[model samples]
Target: MPDCIICHLEITDPNNLFECPNNHPVHKECLIEWLQHSPNCPLCNEPYSLETKSNLKSDLDKREEEKKKSEEDEARKERNNQIKIIAEKIIFLKFLNMIETLIEKKDFEGALDRLNSIDENKLETVKK
Candidate 1:
């Protein structure tokens, strides 16, 4: 059994193994992490082929795109929440203005009716 250059451990797991073009074997996980930093073999310092390098770039690019997409989704959700909060505030302010106008007109009964129609649960949902 040959030792993995990255981990300095003997490669025991056949399934978790990889080999360079020069036939030098290393742990699969170690080689992948190493490839992220450098394109050369860890022990022999032999550079990987264009095909291998291209594949690595593709994988990295895919991961970056996914990260950006996730971030955009989170930002969109936050913006929507903010918009909802502002809308709720606008609604509350409009209702208050209506109640004030009713009071000014001495329509206490109409103001009380509007106040009673407001749902407490809806207010709690807007707070969150």
Candidate 2:
């Protein structure tokens, strides 16, 4: 991230970068080389990474947020699917009613043909 810590060049890559506690970014490899000689910051010579507080609350909060988002997305998908199924059921019922009315008018063959193409589960669902 520190393309040029002194001159400020274009930072094109971040994989080989590390930020000190003061937010001064440096190349990880270069930092390693510098640390071999002194356990201080490259820019200000301040002690770096001396404190290692294992605060996992932020990580837990991030995981919880991701889980909540996933749950919401799943619920939205399920609701959309339910709406689609209900719409299909309504269409199925309308078609079936049309066939029944046709049968009542004594158009037996046409009614039977239409009924044969009806979704059986949709009829059962509407019946319930």
Candidate that would win on lDDT: 1
Report the Cα lDDT for candidate 2: 0.66
lDDT (C-alpha, whole model) for all candidates: 0.81, 0.66
- Which candidate number would show the highest TM-score if scored against the true structure? 1
lDDT of 2 at 6: 34
lDDT of 2 at 95: 83
Clashing pairs in 2: none
Q: How far off is residue 109 in model 2, in Å?
A: 2.1
lDDT of 2 at 98: 92
- The lowest-lDDT stretch of 10 consecutive residues in candidate 1 is 55-64
Off by over 4 Å in 1: 1-54, 126-128
TM-score of each: 0.60, 0.44
For candidate 1, write residues 1-128 as lDDT tens digits: 88887898999988776677887887866776788677899778898777765756766566667778999999999999899889988877788899999999999999999989989997677556
